[model samples]
Target: MRNFLIDSLGLAGFGAMNYGLYLKFGLADALISAGGLLLLLALAGARAAKRRNESKGAA
Candidate 1:
């Protein structure tokens, strides 16, 4: 479901950032991972919002 995707993607993104930091990866690399995660989260939110709008329109 949508919830599962959001949760898993968010956690994976955070984990990637943390792992990068722990391994002494540079800021640029960390930022890249973080940006990717942000994009995923944004897309998920948009999908949920669109579904909500459609449901309301149907009612």
Candidate 2:
């Protein structure tokens, strides 16, 4: 399914980001990267929620 592929790609991207950050910089930088990842997830969740609400209201 399209959603499965999207989710898989997102997971891969997160894994790559974490791996690269830790490998290149170490723990401290990796923590920063984690915060950034959390922020990104929060923003994405908010966007998804908004779209769902909009769609529900339109229907």
Number of the top-ranking candidate, with lDDT as the measure: 2
Q: What TM-score does prediction 1 earn?
A: 0.62
lDDT of 2 by residue, 1-59 (tens): 99999999988998888889999999899989888988999999999999999999999
Q: In model 2, what lDDT does residue 6 have?
A: 98
**Candidate 1 per-residue lDDT over residues 1-59, each given as its tens digit:** 99999989978878876677757987777778778878988999899999999999999
Task: Report the lDDT of model 2 for residue 48.
Answer: 100
lDDT of 2 at 26: 99
Q: State model 2's lDDT.
A: 0.93
TM-score of each: 0.62, 0.73
The per-model lDDT (C-alpha) reads: 0.84, 0.93
In model 1, which runs have C-alpha deviations exceeding 4 angstroms?
1-23
Clashing pairs in 1: none
CA deviation > 4 Å runs, candidate 2: none
Clashes of each: 0, 0
